[model samples]
Structure formats: structure tokens, C-alpha cells
Target: MISAHLPALQVVIPLLAAPACVVVRQSTLTWLLALLVSWISFAIALTLLVQTFFNGPMSYELGGWAAPLGIEYAVDVVNAFVLVIVSGVSSVVLISAKESIERETHIKRTHLVYTGWLLCLTGLLGITITGDVFNVFVFLEIASLSSYLLVSLGPDRRALTAAFQYLVMGTIGATFILIGVGLLYMMTGTLNMADLAQRIPGVAQTTTVRAGFAFLVLGISLKAAVFPLHYWLPNAYTFAPSAVTAFMAGSATKVSIYLLLRFFFDIFSETFSLRTMRLDLILLILGVIAIFSMSLVAIYQSNVKRMLAYSSVAQVGYMVIGISLATTTGLTAGIVHLFNHALMKCALFLALGCIVFRLNSVDLKDLAGVGRRMPWTMAAFVIGGLSLIGVPATVGFISKWYLVLAALERDWWWLAFMVVASSLLAVIYIWRVVETAYFKTGPVANTEEAPLILLVPTWVLIVANIYFGVSAVDTISFATRAADQLLSTF
Candidate 1:
């Protein structure tokens, strides 16, 4: 029975756990439930990925009703990859969050926090697993709503303001996506992404199709915090609880990028949007601007979390640049970076979570010279930072290598140079914190490191950064295959 309904179980396990969380209503109980659900999602994601890789894409109609008429849960290499990212990262972050949450969050709200975490996990996984466009919007909202709540959970009152700011921007982005989805449905009379892909091209020349494509891309850009649209990110990350910030810094925008890739490569005809409308050039130019501009901003930030937040904007440019190249190699580079950057950033943020848990601050001044006292934690941070700088033997290096290779593949020499230059900017920004943590002296001298509860997860991701960096074949292969799947449509 479970075998037959694995697709349903993939999403249902976390979905059902949300209510079970409310029923438990005790902080420790809720924490255990949340951890169980995340682990369940992680197992199911792995099972689904295995099933898809071995068996090809899998689809199950709700109530056994076939689509384009019925709702469907689906899995493909692209989304299977994403499901693994979301669930796998959430599990690691949860172990660390257990300690961070207790210190930073109110005891009374701990149960609510766990509930939101489970729902957010479910919503994010649902977005990746669903086959229908309307369903994407629904799950996007579910995740966004939970995200707002989580961001506001910090002890700082500024977290409330940040959450509100994020909510306002998120709502606008979601509305735009909904309208785009509605436009596609109105034109094609179908909501299934696969079916819409089949139908939209029949009417691809219409102005409405063009408009829908524009709205959809723009909406995704906003949700993904692409470049100029990233105003809400820094504060939101800076003020959010360590656990929430760590999880989101790694997962949220990455999910939005998945949606953007799906719509651009699958649901819409690239000939119309990229060729006729010239979105490729526009995206390329904006991507370059984002890479440099945000990296420069990152260098001067006083707070470590906010700096990383800006670095995320810069990373978005790399993914966009890969896509704008409009080649299999280019898309493969972008997709692989999506996976690589998630691991690297999650590790970095988890390291920061340790710092925040111990020292109660992510400020550069606060991190001063504790490097010796918190050697393991700071060592993990430095390694994660090196990964961010694309150092020789880390995940970051592999991602930038692919991005550079993609640029050269397009004969875009200037783009290739820009990629290198962006790496230089990354070096400058990552160096700031390194300087503060290791070079400068602290005010008092005896500040200790965060406990094993947090360090364990941080180190897990830190080691993962190096492991995936060294063993790049699997990520490269899956990304290439997924890119081929996407480029075939173009």
C-alpha cells in the first residue's frame, strides 16, 4: 500500500504532521514530531529520487483521476533533486535548530515554531513535488506564510519589522505568480505544467502568452530575490532566529529558482520569450550587475548574517547567467550551482547559528578572536567561507568552475571575465569576517563555542561542502541530465 502511494506519501507525511503538531501542543513533543516529519520527508525524497532515476519520472493522479483533468503529484530529476535539497537540508538544520530555538525563541511559542517549521517543510516539499501550476501557487503561499512567521520569531523586535517587510514583498510576488498562472490557464484551459507545456505553444504567438511569461518570470525573480529585487532579504536574514535564517538562507530562494527554471524551460516556449522578446540578453546583463553590485555591498556589512544575505544575491546572478546562456552546458552549470550553493550556504549559516547561540551576536566585532576558543566552530565557518570564496577543494570552486566553463562555451569572453571578477568580490566579502574572527582581538577573552548540538550539524554541512566538492560527478551528471531535459524543450 505504501509502495503504491509513495508519491502521495512524499507530500502527505509532512502535510499531515502539521495538524498532529497542533494536537501534541507541547514544545518538546512538537520538536520530536517536527524532526520525525523532516526525517520522513528526507527518506521519501531519497526514495522518490531513486525511483525516478531508475524508473524515469513518476506521476500519480489524486484519487486515481488522470490529468489534465485531475490533480497530480509528480517527480522528475529536476524536482527530485530539489526535494532532496529541501528535505535533506531541513533535517540537518533541525538538529541544530533544537538548541538554537531553545535559547532564542520563547518557550510558549516553541510549539508554534515547530508547527510552522513542519508546515514550511511540507509547503516547500509540496511546491517541488506538485505537477499543477495552481498547486505551486498554493504551496508557495503556504511556505511564504510559514516563512514570515519563522522570521519574526527572533527575540529582537526588528524581526517583527523584517517579517512584515518580507510579507509585503512576498505577497506581491505571489500575486504576480497567481496572475501569471491564471493567464496560462485562461489561454490553455489547463493547469498541469506538463499539459500546459503541450498546449501553450499552440497559442504561443499571442500577446497574452508573452505577457503571462513576463509576469511569471518577474514574479519568480522577486521571490528568488534576484538582484535589484532583493531589498527584503538582508534584514530578514539578519534579524531572523539563527535556525530560521540558516534554513531559509539555504533553501527559500533556491526553491524559487526551481520554479523559474520550470516555467522558463518547460511551460513556456523559449523561442517566443528568449528569442523574440530578448529576455536572455536582459537577464544576462542584470545577472552581471547583481553579481558585482551585491558582492560589493557584502564587503562592507557589519553583520555576518546580513553579509551572507547579500552574498546570496550575488549567487543568484551566477544561476541566472547560466540560464541566460541558453545552452545545455549553461543550464547544467546553473542547476549544479543551485545544489552546491545550498550546501555551502547552509553550512555557513549553521556555523553562524553556532556563533549566535554562543555569543548572541553575528556582528563582526562580536566574533573577534574567539577563533581560538571556538576553534572547531570557527574552523567550520572558515571552511564554509572558503567554499563561498570558491577555494580550490570545496563545493564553491566546482560551482564557479561550471559557471566559467558555461561562459566560455558561449564564446562570451566578457561574461567569463565577469565571472572571475565576481569571484574576486566574493573573496573580499568573505575576508571581512575572516579578518574579524581570526585577526582581531576580542573585548574579553574567554567566550566559549556553541555546544555539540549545534556544532554537529554545522560540521556535517561543512564536511559535505568538501565531500561534494571533491566528488562532483553525481551533481554534475544529475544537473546535466536535468539541463538536457530542460533544453530539449527550448
Candidate 2:
């Protein structure tokens, strides 16, 4: 009975906690409630991942309704891995949020901040676990709306502007997704993803189906911050509170990427014409461009947070490259990097959060000599940076090794070379921060480090980067299963 309810409880726990936080109206109590909810969700995700692995995919129909008639929460290898990533990152970020929230948001609105945080968490989990196509759009908007509120709560005046821009873009993305879902419903007369997968093959030749696929891919790509459409991400991440940035940056776009994988490999694979649409080629070209161009942009950023934001886009390119390869190996690489990148980015951003907490700045110049003052925090940054560069014996290296192997499997040596060269760009940008932090000297003498409360979570992720890298069998196994599940749908 408990196993059967895991799907519903995964989203419901956080969904209910959002309203509870508002009604309680006590800032510290609300934060504690949110943290408890996030950790519970994380545990539930682990159980679901293990359950799916041993028992095959599990589907829980809402209200005892079955098939095309009612909504379902399906947990397969594909989304089970993503559920772990989203809930796991949320737990880590919430653990560090209390101090960051007090510093960035007004005490009067702290309860409101917790409300939005839990709502955002609920929406993200709902998107990952839901089996209805229309429900995906509904949850997407929920997350997007709360995301705007979170960004707007940042200390800077530009937070308002950033939030507004994200709102406009997020609305457009959500609308396009709804339109695509509507078109599919028109053709199939079903809202459930499984039913649509079965119905789509019959309508594969219809222009409406092709158009819907096009719209969905473009819309999801925008949300995933896949190059050209990524204009909203840098500003939003840079201006949002550090904890908010860590949570969203680590999990949000990855959910979009999961949506893309679900629709294309699961739904469109039934149609078998996505390849004829030349999507693979398009993604490969765009992915290569994104990898190089965004890394270049990151190299020039004066603000450290914005720099990492651009790096996020570049990292997304690596995922796209894996998807574009259209092989099981390629998909496995993408899925593996999806989880690994979340770890590295969270560690890096949380380390920056520690810097911001102590120094009150994330400017490259302000970080000068920080390594001496905050050795543990800066050391975490260095270790995270090494992982970002795909250095040997770090989680990043494992992802890149798989990516290169996938490229070679496709006989695309050039793409393999691109992966290595782009990693070199990460080296340069990370070195820029290292030079400023350890080598360069600040005028003021400072000797304060972040409190243990923040340092513990930050270092935990850093250690994971190494621990998982050295013993990557478990992560690789899960990713391989997810890839196989997606590919088997073909």
C-alpha cells in the first residue's frame, strides 16, 4: 500500500506544505516545515527509483480511473532518475536557505518566500511524475509563476526586471506547450501520455501532428535554456537569492530536458518520423554552437554568479549533444550528465552562496583573496570547478567520458573533439575565478568563513562529486536503465 501511494505522495506532500507555510505565518516555523517536506520528498524519490528498478514501471491511476479516462502518475526508469535529482537538490538547497533567505528577503515576507519555494518544488515534482500531457503544462505554469516570485524577491532592483522578463517568456513557453497538447488531444482524444503514444502512430502523417511536435520541441527547448532561447536564464539566476539560484539552476531546466526526452523518445518514437524532421542534425549543430559560444560568454562575465549561469547553458548543450546522437549510448550519456551536472552546479553555486553570505558580494574582484579567508568555502569551489572542467576522478569526467564514447560510437570524432575543447573553456573560466580568489590580493584583510550550517551542505555536494566519480557504477547503472527504457519505446 505504501509503495502504491509513492507516486501521489511525492507531489502532494510538497503541494500541501505550500499552503501550510502561508497559514502558519511564522517565518522560522515555515522554513522548518518546508525543509522537512523537501527531505521527505527526497526519501520518497529514492524509494520510487528503487521500486521502479526492481519491479519495472509503476503506474498509479488517480481516483481508480484507468487508461485514457483519468490522470496517472507513472514512475519508470526515465522519470524516476529525474525525480531523485529534483528532490535531492531541493533538500540540499533548503538546508542552506534559512540564512540566505533572511539576508536576501524582508522578514515581513519570509513566510511568503517559503510559500513560493514549496509551490515551486511541488510543481517541479508534479511535472516529473505526472503521466498526463495536459497536466505537464499545468504544472509547468505553477513552477514558472512561483519562479517569478522567487526571482523578484532578490535584493537588487533588477530582480523585478529579471522576474518580469522571465514571466513574459515563461508565459509564451507555457502557451506553446498547451497548444501542442491541445493539438495532440484533437488528434488522439486522450490526455494521457501512454494513450497518446499509442494513438500518435495512426496520425503520424498528419500535418497537425508534425506541427504539434515542432511547437512542443521549441517550447521545451526554451524552458531548458537551450541556446538562443536562453536569454532569460542569466539575468534570473544572477539576480535571484543565492539559495533560489542554487535550487532553480540545479533542477529547473533539467526538468524541461526530461520533458523533451519523454515526448521525443517516448511519444514521437511511436510516430518514427522525428528523425526525418532532421531534429537530430539541428540539435547537434545548435548544441556545438551553444557549447562554444556560451563558454566564451561565461569567460567574459565580471560577476561570478552570471558566469556560472552562462556555464549552465553551455552544460545544457552537452546534454543536447547526447540527445542529438539518437543512440542508446548517447541518451545514456545525456541522462548521466543530467544527474552529474546537477551535483556540480549545486556545489559551485552553494559555495558562491557561502562567499556571498560572508563577503556580501559575488563580483570577481570581491572574491580576490577569499580563498585565504574562507579556505573551506574556496576549496569547495575549487573542487567543484575541477568537476566542472571534467577533470579526471570527478563526476564531470564520467559524464564527458560517456559523451565522447557516444560520439565515437556514431563515428563523429569531430563532435568528440568538440566535447574536449569546450571543457577546456571551462578550465579557463574556472581558472579566472581561481586566480582572483587565491592568487590575487584584496586591499582589505578579512578572516571570516561561512557558518558550519552552510559549509556542511556545500561540502557534502563537493564530496559527492568525488565519491560518485570514483565509484560511478550506481549512477551509470541508473542512467543506462533510463536510456534503455526510453529507447525501448521505439
Query: Per-model C-alpha lDDT, please?
Result: 0.88, 0.91
TM-score of every model versus the real structure: 0.98, 0.98
- Sliding window of 10 residues with minimal summed lDDT for model 1: 266-275
In candidate 2, stretches whose alpha carbon ends up further than 4 angstroms from where it belongs are 270-273
The CA lDDT at 418 in model 2 is 96
lDDT of 2 by residue, 1-490 (tens): 7878999999999999999998999989999999999999999999999999999999998888995788999899889999999999999988889998787666576888989999999999999999999989989988999999999988788988999999988888888888888888889898898888888989988999888888898889889999889999999999999999999988999999999999988888822634767888888999999999999999999999999999999999999999888787899999999999999999999999998888778999988898899999999999999999999899999999999999999898899999999999999999999999999899437559899989999998999999999999999999999998888774
Estimate, for each residue in 353-439, the C-alpha lDDT of model 1 and write its tens digit.
888887888888888897877899889988998998899789998988988898898788999888988889888878888888888
Cα RMSD to native, each candidate?
1.2, 1.1
For candidate 1, the lDDT comes to: 0.88
